[model samples]
Target: MKQFYLSLIAFFTWVIGMAQSGGDSTRLPLTDSIQAKKSTFTIGAVYANDASYYGQRSDERLPYVALAAAYHHRSGFYLTGMGYRLLNDSARLASAYSLGAGFSFPLGKSFTADLSYDYSIYPKFSPFLQAANPHSVNLTIARESVVDLSISGDYAFGKTNDFFITPQISRDIDLFNIGRNDLVSFNPSLDMTAGTQHFYEYYQEEKGIRDSILGILMPPVLGGSPSEQNPTIKTTNRFEILSYNLKLPVSYNRNHLKLEVSGQFSLLSKQAQSQPGKVNSFFSAAFYYQF
Candidate 1:
C-alpha cells in the first residue's frame, strides 16, 4: 500500500510538470479578456444522500443544509462565507463555518493561477481523554476541527467555451494538536456551461497510532476519557485515495437560477487494522440564486 501511494504521488508530480511545460499555447476563456468588471452577491445550498455529516459515522442521509454568500468582482478577486448543518435521524450531528479569500492572476493568454486561504471551525474534543478501554468509555463521538490551505493553477482549452482543467495541491492541518497528519492532493477537472463538471483526485494522508486505538474502542464503548495514569498507545497511519466526482456547477450572474448534481467515490487504506480505512460513495444536488 505504501508503494502504491508513493507511485501515485510521482504520477501527479509528473502531470504537473507536463502541464506547465506544454500549456503556454492553450486558449484562454473570453471572460478573462472582458474588462467590464462588477461585484455581485450570491447564495447557494446543497443536499446530499447517504453523506456522512462532519465525517461522523453516526450521520445518515436525512438532510444537510449549506448556506453561502460571496462577493465576486470581474477583476478576479473574491471573498466568501459558508455555513453547513448536518442532521441524522431527528438530531443535529454537526455544524461548520468557513471563510475564504482568493485571487486569480493570468498566467499568459488563457491560463490562471489561484491562491486562496480558508479557515474552518469544527466542534472540539480532547484526544487525550478519548483513549479508554472498550467497556469503560461511554462518551458520545466527538468531531475534529481542520483548517486547509491550497494553491491551484488551471488552463482554459476553449476560447468561448466553459471547459477547463485545473490541478490543485492542498495541505490540511488539525487545529487541535497542531500535529502534522497533513495530506497532499491533486484534482483534475472538466466542465461545461450548463453547470456540469467531472473531476478526479488522488490524495494521501499520514495517520497515527492514537487514531487506531480510538477506532477499536469507539464501536463497543459508550463513553469516558482514559485514565490519566495509563500508558498512551503508539502507532503510525498512512493512506492513499483515488476519488472521482461528477459535479454540477452553480452560477448565478444576476437574478439567475441554477441546479447541479455531483457524486464521489473513494478507496481507503488496506493495512490499517483498527482504522483500516474506507470505501465510500455519495451523490448530491444543489439549488442556488443570484441577486
Candidate 2:
C-alpha cells in the first residue's frame, strides 16, 4: 500500500511539472467518480473563492455559491442543472444558471467516452468572463491505467465562437478506509489547454464599452489618461496553448454522501495579452448527497 501511494504521488508530481514547463484548463469527466449500479439522483452545493475560464479572469474577485442537481441513469444518460449566486457587491442577485445533458459509455474494458451539451444563462452585465459563451458542446475520451488519462474537445458559442482542447492526467490515492462504505482519498490532476481567445475578446469589448460610459459620466480628472479610460485590447484569435493547471482534491465518501475540498493553481501563457505569464490560484469546497 505504501509503495502504491508513493507511485501515485510521483506520477502526479511529474505530470504537473511537465504541464508547467510546457503550458491548461479544467473540465472533469461527465460521469460521477463513484458510480452506482442503478440510477441515482444527486444534489450538491459548492462555494468557491473565484471563477475563471481557461485561466482568464476579471479584475475583481468573483466568489460564488452554487447549487446543483443531477440525475444519472443506469443507461449512461445524465441531466444536470446548476444555479449560481455571486457573493460580490454587484447589484445582480443571481449570477448564472446552467443546464446540461450528457451520455457516458464505456469504449472498452479500460476506456470510456462522454458526449455532452451545456447551455448557460447569465444576467446582463455579468462580470464573469465565461459569460461570453453561453453554449458549449464537449466530447471527452478517457483511459484508465495506473493513472487516468483523458482528452476533451469543446466548442463554445454565443457572442463569439471559441474552440478548446484539453489533455489531462490524474490519479486517486486511498487515504483511509473506515468501513466497506466509507473511505477517504486524495486526487491530483494536471491539465493543459489549447484554445482560441474570441471569448476573451468579447469580454474586453464589453468592458471597454462600460468603461467608456463611466468615463463620460465621471470627470476626466477621475479617469486618468485616454488610454486608461479606454485601453485598446489586442485579441489573438488563433488557437494556441493557453494555460497549464494543477489540481489537488481530497474527498471523503460515506455511503451516499461525498465531501470534497479542492484547490487549483494555474499558469497562464505569455501569449495572454492582459496578464501574460500570470499565476492564479482558486479554492473550493463542495458536498454531494446521492439518492
Candidate 3:
C-alpha cells in the first residue's frame, strides 16, 4: 500500500516533467525554426488517462486536464505558464500552476541546448505528490541526425532536493501528407532515467495529517499506532536507475495547429519497487496552437 502511494507520487512527477519539456523528453518544441523570425505565442490543452513515472503507476485513476500558454521570442528566449485541474474526487477546482522561463539555442551544426527554470504553486493541502518540490532547473542537450539523441538533467528543490538524468534516442517518421501544408507523423523514443528519491521521504513525513484523520476514523488498536500506520520506507540518497521507458506519439500538424496522442510503457528497475521489475503504461492526448 505504501508502494502504491509512492507510485502515485511518481506519476505526478513524471507528468510535470512531460509538461515542462514540451511533451517530449529529449527536445524543446519552442525552439523550432518557425519561431526564429519573430516572437510566437502558443496555447495548448492536455488530458491524460493516468500518470506514471518510470514504471511506477498510480493505483487509482488520477485523470487531469491542463491548459498552458507560452511565448517564444525569435532570439530563443521563452516564458510559459500552465494550470492543472484534477478531474478526480477532489473539491479543489484548481490543482496546481507553474510558471517558467527558458532559453534555447543551437550549439553547432547538429547540436542544440536548452536551459530552463520552473516554479510550481500548489495549495497548502494539495494532494499532488510534486508539491514537495516547488522549484526546478533543467538543461537538455540534443544532437540532430538520422536518429535524434539527447540527454537531460534536472534538479528539483524545496522541501527536499532530487536530481535526475535521462538519455534518449528517437526517430520521427512521416506517415502521410495532408494537403500541402499538413502531415501526420509517428515519433518513437527510448529513454532511461536515473534519479534519487528524496522527495519520497518528504512525502512520507507529510502524510501525518492524513494519517491522523484515518486514526480518528479507525482507532489505534485497529488502525495501529501512527508510527505503524506510517512506517518509514527506507530510501537511499544515492542515485539509482529508476526505469526504462519507450514512448510512441502520433501527431497531426495542420497550419498553425498540432494535435498529438501519445502512449508510453516503462519497465521499472529494482529501485522503483512496490514489486520488483514492474511495468506501467500511460496515455494522453493534447492539442497546441500557435499564433
Best by the TM-score measure: 2
lDDT of 3 by residue, 1-291 (tens): 367446545643554344322222222243463225688888899898775545455334567899988999888888999998889737777788999999888899989899999999977645555567999999999897666789999998998898989998776666678788877877777788898877766554555455565463433657678566544356548788888787889988887788899998877777762334777788899888888
lDDT score, candidate 1, position 85:
73
Model 1 C-alpha lDDT versus the unseen true structure: 0.35
Error of 1 at 94 (Å): 7.1
**Which candidate, 1 or 2, would have the higher TM-score against the true structure?**
2
Model 3: C-alpha RMSD to truth? 7.6
| Shift in Å, residue 130, candidate 1 | 17
Candidate 3 clashing pairs, residues 3+ apart or interchain:
none
lDDT of each: 0.35, 0.77, 0.73
Clashing residue pairs, backbone N/CA/C < 3 A, model 2: 24-192, 24-193, 24-243, 24-244
lDDT of 2 by residue, 60-151 (tens): 78899999999888888899999999997466666899999998888999898989999999876667787789999999999976567999
TM-score of each: 0.45, 0.84, 0.82
Candidate order (lDDT): 2, 3, 1
